[model samples]
Target: MMTEQRVELAVTKSELGARLQTSESQVAELKRENEAQAVDLSAMEDRSNSTELQLQEHKTVMEELKSTVEGLKGHIAERPKVAFSAALTDAGSVGPFNTDITLIYTKVITNIGNHYSPATGIFTAPMRGVYYFTFICHNYGANIRFGSLLYKNGERIVSMTDWQTSTDHDDNGSNAAVLQLEVGIRSTCVSHLTARSMMTVIITAPSAASCSSPCEQKTLQHLQRLPALPHVSRRPCSTFSGFLLFPM
Candidate 1:
């Protein structure tokens, strides 16, 4: 009987030991699985951060492109028109005198903000481009001499001195000057005359042929339709008549 009891005790001890080993193995497997989950979580966090950074970069680039497009649109909208006109004189003078006469003068005349003139009859530009200008003077037949066509901002592109003589019924002579301009400049067409008589000043556009329609459409119609002409005092020395045309 003692031997049988001892055998049973040993068997029970062995079974308990086996059960403990199995439990320990299961706990180890669970710990390993938890460790794998942690690694996967860390990798997912890194991927999310990288994707966010890429998205922000793309947004910034898009905004920059939008701003660039807007700037270009504004520049194109502000491009200049081809024709314009202005009046430079305010009074009339009677015949029979010789002196230096300034016919047309103005300060606020310009085709674009890029181009402007002082009130003293000068035209200037802020940048470089092809510019056309003209000045006309009416004088009596002593001798009409066209002086300097000064380009104030840049070198003169073109000029003419003794083109031809002007004829009128009252022995008056007319002179016209055409000039080509460059960027960042102004110009003045001056005339020196020997004899004295009644005069009117007219300045035409760059190419009276090409710009005529636009000039007439945009400028001349508006100017001619002004409610009334300004009153002018008569002078005895020389009559000054001023007319501006952007003829079509």
Candidate 2:
């Protein structure tokens, strides 16, 4: 009986030892899993921070672009207004085509609030397209030939002559002329009419035309003021005005 008891005790002790070994292996595996989870968490945090920084940079760039656009709008809104006027001489004959009776006077009259000086008033052409030009001349009863000429860059583009006036006593004749020009060109009108005569000229962009590369469209608005002139006893004379329009 004592030997049997000893064998039973030894077997029980061996079983207990094996069970403890198994529990220790399980605990080691759980510790390794926890360590792996910690590494994964650290990696995820790093990526999140990088993404946040990138988003902030993009947001800042967007804000700067918005500010630039607003500043450009304000500058355009503050542009100055352009205005002009002219007067005729008293008691003079207009012309027989190259006659000295035609007198021309030009003046710049800007608004008090938004005034532009002549030095800065001249605008550069914004495109390389075609432009349309027109001139009109009105003659009172001077019986003299009346005409108007358009000049571009100091060169004549078109000249109009009165077809109704045949003699020096002819009255109430009017003339008009039209021409086409290239963009980036500067021009003016010359009036060859008697005293108390009036003339008007206009230059505008051509439809279906495109601007040159790296150029932008400019804004143009008409503002005019007529200057008073002395009364002439010859014929009732007409008045004059001028205008220019930008990119087509």
Candidate 3:
């Protein structure tokens, strides 16, 4: 009986030791899991802080861009607007003057900046800039030379002439120029006709029917005195127009 009791006590002690060893192993695994979770939480916190910093920087840049855009808008609004268009007249015809005469464009079609004068038939530049100018002339006569000249500050810049000797009594001519004008510069169109005496004149008359480019001019030295000079039409067909292309 004593031997059996010893064996049972020894076996019970061995069983208790095995159970304690398993419990210790489980505690160690639990500790390792907790440490891994702590490291993951720290990394997540760093990422979140980085994201917030980037967002703040982006917001500041957007605010600066908005301010710059508003300033540009104000600058554009303050720029001057310049454009003009005018016609000679509604009357039948304008000129056969013995000397050069500035054609008055009394009919104002569009005068945006009011730089063109219907009173003086001149366009005064309001600011230094590049401008585009165009003019049209219509003549009504047979065997008569007629045209207009664009003058800048009293000097001729360009001229357009149309002479017709055929049965067609109507002729049309137009010219355009792009010019860099300074402030206070004046531009005008004039009847390009010059006559020294009633019997003769230096004009842009075609010597022959097939006069080539830069056609030759003839002197009307002994030609019969013209009863009435060819008339430049005062209708809207004869017009002067200009606009600001870009500001310097």
Candidate 4:
């Protein structure tokens, strides 16, 4: 009986040792899992911080862009207004040509704004604005077919047709247009008339205080040489004129 009891007590002690070993291993596994979770959470926090900084930088850049845009708008608004007027003096007998030709004006009545170029017969807009333009052609030759056109760039925008007056009377007419012109825009007058006819064209527009291009100075220099002749004509005369109506 004593030997059986001693055997039972030894078995019980061995079983208790095994249970303790299992508990110790489970505790070590739990500790390792907690350490891995901590590392993962720390990495997630770092990424979130970087993303927030980038967002802040982008916002700053957007604000700067907005400011620059506003400044440009203000500068454009402050640009000067534009106005010009011109008229033609005696362009001796023109166009005895076999084919159609463009007449160039050598005389100008007024070029207050300096936008009109007598050299090229083109009016360049100094700024974007609504403008009024008028062109008149008077021919003193019977049996003459006289016509005029207003051109934008190289294309014909409008045409003023020829009017035949009675025998021994001058054939004269005028055409006018109100244009919404743009900055850096160009316009001109061209004439197609019969041979040996004395025709005069006149152009007029309101003058602006300042122009946006350096051509304004050249306009002044040319204006100085233009002989201030009296247009004391009882008969119809040719004229061209324009002015800024308003800005767009």
Candidate 5:
């Protein structure tokens, strides 16, 4: 009986040792897995920080873009609307005298912004915008060349010429233009004329006064519609007019 017991005890001790070895192997594997997980967690944290930085940069750029757009909106809103036009009021005429002179429109048919002065024969811009101008001219068939020009800021933009080609007929012509004008820019109609007696023209406005060139003279810009006419003058013949299309 004592021998049998010793053999059983030895067997039991052997089994216990095998179990401890298996447990140690499993512990070692668990330790290695834990270390790898720690490494992965550190890398993930770095990536998370980088992603956060990118988000912050994007947010800053968006903010700047928003500010620029707002500034543009404000600028557009601040721009003003402007328009104006004028024409003849009565019958009139200028020179048969041989002299180049600017036509001053003393009578105003319409001055929307009061920017055009019949006295100066010029339209002064109140705001930056695109403008349209028109002029009509006529002459007494007194063997004279009837001519007119559109002037912008003292520069010639266009003109109309009507020569009494037929002694039996009165001469007439018209011209137009579209101009981009800024504040302080002035526009007017200049009359180019040849010798004759009285000339009469009509429209929303006048015929023209002869103008001298380089086209820059300030006062000699436009013409009067109604001539300070002679008794039985051709009633009304031409017009000088303009209007704003939109703000530039």
Candidate 6:
């Protein structure tokens, strides 16, 4: 009876030891799972922080771009629109004057800023800016030559001369210049006349009294000969055009 009791006690002790080993193994496995979960959570937090930083950076860039665009729009809106185009006459001939004469482009086609005056044959700059000017001279029939001089504040800037040849009856000459002008500076086109006197001196407004000494009576007589051209044709015989390229 004693031996049987001893064997049973031994079996009970072995079972308890195995149960302890199993419990320890489960505890180690749980610890490893908890460590892995903690690592995953840390990685997720890092990614979220990185995404938030990138979003902030993109938002800041967008704001700066928007501000720049708005500023450019405002600048464009404030810039003044300055441009003008005019024609010398619809009538056939203007020259054969005794002396040089300022050619008045009386027929205004487009005068956006109204800086060019038809009354005086002059363009007055409204502001300090870089300006572009162009002129066209046309002559047809006979042994006629057309010459024009562009002047800025009484100083010559450019000149154009066209002559009708035996083969070519019609002739056209053009000149263009980019000029830096000051506020209130005057620009004019003057016709250089020869002995024949067929081209310029064709002033009707403010009279011929404003002309040089030799031109008054001759201009008046010519005015009497030629009638006023109220209606002009589609194509212009001569043209003077200018525009403000940019403000200084």
**TM-score on alpha carbons, each prediction:** 0.34, 0.39, 0.69, 0.46, 0.49, 0.68
Q: Which ten residues in a row have the lowest lDDT in candidate 4?
A: 212-221
- Summarize candidate 1's per-residue lDDT along 2-93 as a digit string, tens digits: 99999999999999999999989999988998899889888888988988998999999899999998998987666544433443333432
User: What stretches of model 2 exceed 4 Å from their correct place?
Assistant: 1-5, 79-149, 157-248
The CA lDDT at 200 in model 6 is: 35
For model 4 the TM-score comes to 0.46
- Ten consecutive residues with minimal summed lDDT in candidate 1? 212-221
Name the best candidate (by lDDT).
6
The CA lDDT of each predicted structure is 0.37, 0.38, 0.61, 0.52, 0.54, 0.62
For residue 1, give model 2's deviation from the true position in Å: 4.9
Tens digits of per-residue lDDT, candidate 6, 144-213, equal: 5445555544445566555545565555666777887777766666554455433432211221111101
Where model 3 places Cα greater than 4 Å from the true spot, the runs are 1-47, 153-156, 195-235
lDDT (Cα, tens digit) per residue for candidate 2, span 63-106: 99999889988966754332333323334433322212223322
lDDT value, candidate 1, whole model: 0.37
What's the candidate order when arranged by decreasing lDDT?
6, 3, 5, 4, 2, 1
Q: How close is candidate 3 to the true structure, as a TM-score?
A: 0.69
For residues 54-73, write the lDDT of model 3, one tens digit per residue.
89988998999899989989
Q: Model 4: per-residue lDDT, tens digit, 1-248?
A: 99999999899888888988888888888888888888988998898898899889899999998999899889767755566655543533333333333334446666756877878666777878888777665544334444555544343445544434446435456666677766766655544323433222222233321111100000011112321212313322555567778777
TM-score of 1: 0.34
TM-score of 2: 0.39
Q: Give the poorly placed runs of model 1, Cα more than 4 Å off.
A: 1-71, 78-84, 94-104, 107-111, 138-167, 170-183, 194-248
